[model samples]
Target: MKNACYCVTEHRAPLQRIIQDTPELTGDQVLLRVTASGVCHSDLHFWEGRYDIGDGQDMSLSDRGVTLPLTMGHEIAGEVVALGPDASGIDIGAPYLVYPWLGCGDCAVCDRDEENLCPNQARSLGIFTPGGYAEYVVVPRAKYCLPLGDLDPARAAPLACSGVTTYSALGKFRDAIRTDPVVIMGAGGLGHMALRMVRALSGKGAVFVDLDPAKRQAVLDAGALAAIDGAAPDAADQIRAATGGGARLVLDLVGAESTITLGLAAGLKGVRVVVVGMFGGQIKLPTVYFPMRAMTLEGSYVGNLKELRALLDLVRSGALDIAPVTRRPLHDANAALMDLRDGKVVGRVVLTPDPA
Candidate 1:
């Protein structure tokens, strides 16, 4: 069988369609006919081939073990087509959300179900391996497939990334989130996901900050306590006022220096800020503030498999509101990426498989 996929043949260039023989399944491996793939901000980093780590420097994906002609999507949902002899539990033809943040199975972190924090060579799908930008894909193990039940594949696809990412980030502020409204920075895809998840987790509510008025309005319509302009002169004041003083928890989904600065400025003493966005930049903070303010800063990567399952359960129970998602045909993968790159995407843009 032939598999067709769109790949980043060159950095900052158009994705090229490539046809190759479908991969043969090995021990414990499973084959999937990709039903939906989400276009993520992370994909932009892969396509650009580097991360702006500030100081006029970049961290190249090649140094991090990414190679050309790679398919760049980690948020995937698909139907099982074939299973290896050792693969069990899941039946053929069942639709599932692929857990793409894979790690070496032998690591201690993996043993604890924290594969996303694995130290070994990352086997993350779409980054270190072929991903769901294709008509078909090979999952390293059946264990990576989470049953989607009745969830729409297009809507469920982002659960692999944005959903689980925000879930894990919010989990870090359990105490604060339950008692106080979280200050969410960036109203992009991840920002919106974080907003919805805050409510689902039984949090007080959320106040969103973004440069876009449209996205701010969208967040307001979605029931956020307030959506302040990130660029406003008194943005921090607005966030502080909205939170009734200062925010106890801030989820920075846009990790740029300005966003982080804004988050810190809006934080109350003992505030916990979790930076989940990959929009990179550097910041310099006074050392004394950490001790004086009792502040905590941390970075959260895409979540572990266990968190993905937990998030899925929330969606299945209908307690979690789905983020706005726009569906496009798979053939428009390049266009979808461009839309997301140009800041034109509202919520999430999911690419559904085009008919064979």
Candidate 2:
């Protein structure tokens, strides 16, 4: 089979088109025909050398390295054509959302459902390996691929990263803040998704904070009862007032020091702050901040298999639908990324390998 992909030839050049040969399917792997790949902010970070993935074996390590001539696209979904040895429960020609994050399953973290933090983890179809930008991808571990039953392939792509990240963050604090209000910062892909996931997962608090009026409106559209600006001097105060003097949870998808600090201020007596954005910055709160408010600041990457499953189920049920995706053909990958960088998107952008 022939694979046609787009690559960033050099550091900041435009995405160039390339054609390559496909290796024969390995016994432990399956060949999947590329379908849809979401234009994620993380990819833009790599393209712009913002994430600073170095030239290394692990994509997370070389978050900014982003060496040249890479076929990139991680948030992916496609149909499986062939499989290799011990690929037991997988069906040929089934549509699946490639989990992409592959980790050594033997680690203690993986054994305890924390595969996202596995030491030997490597991402596929984008960063660490030849991704779904082409016609095919080699899924070494078929078990990691989740079949996309009735879900639209295009919309399901972002669920792998942006969607899964929000779901996992909200799931972590669901039990602690069952009926308390929560704060979500930034209303872009991750923020918007978190608004919906937080409300659906816990049916609890729904406070949103963002600088962009357009994004703040998106938060309201996604069912947030209150949406305000995190840039204002009184932002945190407003959040506290809306949630009755404080919020129980605060998710900072922006990850800037200001946003993280606002999250700290917005939290009440028993609050949890989850930092998940890579906005290229750090946050520091005084020792008294956490101790006095009894606040917890934790960071979360995407998520594990169980959390991804719960996200998939949420989308599958009518309870949650991140659909109405703005889609374009694979050839338009650069344009899509530019859109994301400019904050011109109201919803997630999914790049379809095959034009409809």
Candidate 3:
């Protein structure tokens, strides 16, 4: 059997099409016929070869152990086509959302179901291993496959990343999301997913901030309490006014220095700020304010397997509205990545297998 894939043969270069033998499965492994794969902003960093870490320096993915000729779509949903001898419990014809954040299964973190946080070695798919930008993908474990039920494959694909990332971040705010208007930064894919998850979780609603007028307007039309221009001189004041005071729960989906500064400026004392975006940059703030304001600032990575399952349950119950999705053929993977890089995508973009 043959597997057709689009791979990153070099940084900042177009993905090259490669055909190879389909991987053989073993030790509870499962083989999927790639049904849908969502293009993510993180893929841009991998393609560009580094992350903007503020000042004049950047963090290279190569330094962090990423190698080339990599397949780079982590938000994947696919149909079961074959399985190893030990693989069981999931049917061959069923569709599932693949959990891409993996780790050394013997570690303490993995034992606690926090594989995404494993400090030993990051084995995340689309990063450390082959991923779903192809006609066939090999999952190392059947446990990573979560049933999609009746959800659309393209829409369900992002639940593995954007959906679960926002859900887990919102989970950190706890009941604060219900008591106050949450301040959300960046109205891109993650921002829109955060907004929908807030409403689905029964939060008080969100006040969005973005530099793009179109994105700001898009979220406003989607039911944000207010959409303020993040570049506006009085942007903080606008957020404060929208929240009827300062925001108590602020979710920064864009981790740039300016966005973090805006979020801090717009937050009330004792506020909790969760930074989830990898846009990358650094910020400087007075140390005294940490105690004086009783403020909290932390970062959240993509969520774990348990959270993904919970998020899927929420979607299955019809409580969480799936983010808007744009579909393209698998052959357009390079175009999809470029569009996302240029800030042209309104929501998630999923790549489907090219028709035979």
- Stretches of model 2 off by over 4 angstroms after superposition: 52-66, 104-106, 110-113
Error of 2 at 130 (Å): 1.6
Worst 10 residues of 1 by lDDT: 187-196
Candidate 2 lDDT score relative to the true structure? 0.76
lDDT of 1 by residue, 197-286 (tens): 887889999999999998899889978999999889999999999999998899898888999899899888998989987676789999
User: Per-residue lDDT for 185-239 in model 2, tens only?
Assistant: 8777676677667666666767888888987886787678799987788887899
> Each prediction's TM-score against the native?
0.95, 0.90, 0.96
Instruction: Report every candidate's CA lDDT.
Output: 0.89, 0.76, 0.89
- TM-score winner between 2 and 3, please give it: 3
Candidate 3, TM-score vs. the true structure?
0.96
Which wins on lDDT, candidate 1 or candidate 2?
Answer: 1
Considering TM-score, where higher is better, how would the candidates rank from best to worst? 3, 1, 2
Number of clashing residue pairs, candidate 3: 0
| Candidate 1 stretches greater than 4 Å from native | none
Q: Residues 1-356, candidate 3, lDDT per residue (tens digit)?
A: 79988999999999999998986788899999999998987888888889878787899999988998999889999999999999989889899999999988669998887889998888888888889899989998899999998899998998898888999999999888888988999997678788889899999999999999989998999899999999899999999999998988889998889988888898889988999987766789999989998999989999999999999999999998786689999999999999988878866789999977
